[model samples]
Target: MNTVDEAPRTRRGGRGSRRELRSAIDTTMLPALKRKLPLVEPMDAAQIEQIDRASMDILEDVGVIFRDPQAIADWKSVGADVRDDDRVHLDRGLVRELIKSIPESFTYHARNPANNLPFGNDYSIFVPMTGAPYLRDLEDRRRGPTLDDLASFHKLSHMLPAIHSSAHHIVEPMDHVVAHRHLRITYSSMKHSDKTFMGMTTSPKNAEDVMDMCAILFGDEFMETHAVVTGNCNGNSPLVWDETMLGALRAFCRRNQPILCSPFVLGGANTPASTAASVAQLNAEALSALAYTQVVRKGCPAIYGHYLSTVSMRSGAPMAGTPEISLMNFMIGQMARYYGVPWRTSNTLGGAKTFDAQAGYESASTMMAVLMAGANYVWHSAGWNEAGMHCSMAKFVVDAEQCAMGYRMAEGVKWGDFNEALAAVRDIGPGGHYLGHPHTQANFQEAFFMPELFDNNSIEQWIADGSQEITERALKHVNRLLASYEEPKLDDAVDEALCDYIARREREIPAVDALNNEH
Candidate 1:
C-alpha cells in the first residue's frame, strides 16, 4: 500500500496514441481481478426461484407502504396497484421489466477524471466506514466525532490506495448543527480528497444542497453528462419506504446520480427469523426501491444493496460478520447478477466494542465474504467497530492492509512466462535456494502485495522499536499520513463558489434539532 505524495495527472490525448495509452496504463493502479461466478452459492436455482416467488407474493398480497405521496402517484402511474393512498403492489413482471433499464455497468465520474470508478460485473470498490457517530483512536479512548475528526478520516482515505472512495458522513460531527453539518462534511471531502465521494442523504434538502455544491465544483452540465456522486437510500424494514429516504432517492434518481437502494434488515427483528425468509423480504424491499429509481428516470444507475445482519434473539443486540450475514451476502450477489445490476455490501463490520482480536477476526471474515461474493460497491470497508457505532483510526489502517491483501487475492494466480521460473527451478534443483535469482529481482515490486501498517519485524527489531503493538504502529501511521497530507488543489474560483454556496444555504436553512441521536 504505497502512498503517492500527489495524485497522478490525467493523461492528455485522444484514445489513439499508443504512448499516451501506455502512460495512462502506467499511472492507474491495478484493478481488482474479475472473480469467477458462483464463488459460494448457499442456495440452488430452485430455492432461489422459490424465494423470488415468495417475495413477489409478499409484494402483491401485503404490498409495501410508500409514505411519500409523490412516490405513490408515480407508482400508480406506472401500472402498479396502488391502494389506501400509500400501499403499492408491484407486479413481478413490472419489477423485472423496470430492472432491464438499469445499465449493467457505468462510469462514476470524479472531479479528477483519473479517479473515476466503474461499477458493474466483477469490479469491487472499497469505501471507508461511514455514518458512525463516535470516534476511537489507538489509545482505546472513545468520544463523539467532530468535523476535525471527519477531515482526518477523509485525509486517511485519500492517502490509502486501497480506499477507492471517501464515503459521505464518515462520522457524525456532533459539534455542528444538523441543518448545516452536511454542507461542512461535503466541503471537507471535496477539499481534502480528489476521489469520488457520496452525497448527504439525511433529508431531501440536504441532498439538494449536496447536489448544488457538486454543481458548483463540477458544473451542472458536466454532472448531466457524468455521475460524480452517489447516495444511499434505505427502506424501513418490514416493507415500508419512509418519506425522508424517498425524498433523497428522488433527488438522486432524477438527477441521474447513482443510488444504493438498500434494505437495512436486522434478522428476527425487522424481518423474519429465518435467513431464507429474511432474504426474500430483503429482495422485495430492494427491488421496490430500485424500480422506483427507474420510475424517477429510466436508465438511472442504481445498486441492489443488502445490509442484512441477524440480531441476537436473546438480548436483541445486532450482530455483524455472522454466518447468516455472510450467506446473505452471497445470496444477494447471486440475485444482483441475475438481475444484471450492480451490487454493494460492507467490509470490516463487527460487534466488538474495541479494536481487539475479536474486531480483527470479525472484520476479516466479513471482508472476505464481500470480496468472494463479488460486491461492486463496498462501504464500511475499513474502521468500523462496535457494530458500526464507532470508527477507529487504528482499525481503519489495519482493515486497509487487509483490503490490499484481498485485492491481491482477487487477482488469483498469474502464470506469466514460466520459462524463467522453470530455468531458475532447474538451476536451483535439489535443496538449493533461488533467493538471488534474476527473476526475483526483476519482479519483486509487482510480485507481492506489501502492507503498510502490519508489523512484520523480527523479535529483536520489535524490542528495539519499543515492542509496539499493531495498534500503536497504526496510530503512528495515521499521524504520518496526516502530517504529510496534501490537500488536492481545487480551482480558486471553485473554492470560493463552494464557500459562498454553503454560507448562502446556511442562512436560508434555519438551524434544526439535532438529527444524530446515537451517542
Candidate 2:
C-alpha cells in the first residue's frame, strides 16, 4: 500500500510544467472530429431557415399530442391551435419568438461549496454511468438491480471522484410512485455532485415533482441556475416525438433547466433499419429538439446528446454501448459544434460479469471517441457494464484513471526546439542517450505518463515480475484505490443541513397507505 501510495506522489510538478509536450499537439486540428468520421454538416443558413419553416408547418399541420390539460390550456390561451383531444399546434412565428428569447450559456452550481462550474464553450464535465446489467450484492452474488439496489448505487456514485454531474433514475423496476423516491435518493446521495440529471418518465406530475426537488436544492433562485436539472428529450427517428416526454420537456424548459436533447435512434428501430438512417434520425431529432429548446428559451444551455445504437432484432432490445455508438458519438459531436452547442455522450466501460478484456475494449473504444470528439461531457464514463446494467466501484477508479489519461490526451503534446530538452541535440549527440542529460532529468517526468494498468517492460522482465494480466492489474488498482480512498472534505454544517433536508423529505413522502388511499 505504501509503495502504491508513493507511485503517484513521485511527480510533484505544478501546472504548465508540461508546456513543451503540450506544444507538440496540433492546436488547430481536433482529432476527435477527424475527417474519416462522418460529420453531420449543419444546415446552411437558408436550409436552417427552411427546416424551421417546415418544422413550424409540421407543428401547425400535424400538431403534437398533448394530454396535459394545463399545458393544453396554456397553449390555447397563448393562441396556439388546440384540438378537442388536446393535440396542440404551435405556430412557427411563436416558436421563432421563443427561440430568440433564450440565452446561449449558463453556469451550474456544484454541491461542493468550493466549486461552481460553467457549462458551455471550452468547458466540459464527465459524469459516471449508472444502471449496470448486474448488481453486486453484499453476499457477493451478482444480479439485476432492484429498487433497493439503486440506493446503494446512488450512495456510491456520490462518493466517486471526477463524477461532476449525473443522470437520474439509474435503476428502475419499481412503481411510478417510487420514481420520485429514486430521485430523492440520488439527490441526497449526490450532495457532493454539482449537477443532477432528470428522468421525467411519462408523467407530467413527475415533471412538476422533479421541479420541486430542484427548488429545494437551489432555492427559488434555481430558476436561473436551475438548468441544473437537465432533462433528456429523445425522439423516434426522422420526425417523431414521444408525446408523454414532450410535455415533460416543455415543463422543464419553462422552469429554465438545461435541456439535453438525447436522440437514440437504433438501426431498424424507429429508423430505416440502416446506420445512415439511424444517424439521420439522430441528427434530425437533435436539430428539432434544439430548435424547440431555443424557441422555448433562446439560449437555454442546450446540449445535443446523441445516444444512437443498433437494434438486435432477434433480442428485441436496444443493443447499447456498441462500438458504432461511440463512432456515431464522435460524428455527432462534430455536428454539435456545427450547431454551436456543447455535446454530451455516454460510454459504457465496465460490465457486471467481469471487468475483463471485453469491458476494456468496449469502454476504451467509446471513451476514445468521447475524448477524440472533444465532447462537452462524457456520462457513464466508468463503472458501467452489461450495457449499463451494473456498476463496479473498483471499475469506477480504473475508469477515472482512464478519464485522466483522456484529459492528458486532450491536453495535447509538447513541442519545442532542442529536442524537447534545453540542451542542444548536438551537445547531446545522436546515439548518446539523454537519460543522463540534465534536461532529461528536469523534464522527463513532465513528458512521461505513468499508466495505472499498462505494462511497460520486456517479456522476460514481465514474466519475472508477476506474470499478471491487465484485468488483474486493473482489479488490483481498483482494490488499492478503494482501500486508500479518502472521502472528499465538506463543511460540517453544510453536510448536516443537506442530510437534514433529505431526512425531512424522506419522512414526508407517503408510502403504502398513501398509495392505497390515493384519489
- List where candidate 2 sits over 4 angstroms from the true fold: 1-67, 74-97, 100-102, 136-141, 144-163, 166-180, 192-218, 222-229, 234-255, 287-299, 320-327, 349-353, 416-424, 459-466, 489-497, 513-519
lDDT of 2 by residue, 473-505 (tens): 655554333333233444566556555655665
lDDT of 1 by residue, 1-519 (tens): 212222222222334443443443222333433555447777789988888899889888889999999898899888999988899999999998998999899887778777877778878888888999898954557998889899989888887777888787888988998879999999988988888999999999899899889899988888876888989998889899999999999888878889999999999999989888898999999999998899999998899986867899789999887998888888888888878999989888978988888898888889888888889998899899998899999898789778878887876777795687788888878998877888887887777776766778899987887887778778866765665555788999999999999999889998856655432
Residue 508 lDDT in candidate 1: 93
**Best candidate, TM-score-wise?**
1
Cα RMSD of predicted structure 2:
7.7
lDDT of each: 0.83, 0.58
Best by lDDT: 1
Q: Evaluate model 2: give its TM-score.
A: 0.73
TM-score of 1: 0.92
Q: Each prediction's TM-score against the native?
A: 0.92, 0.73
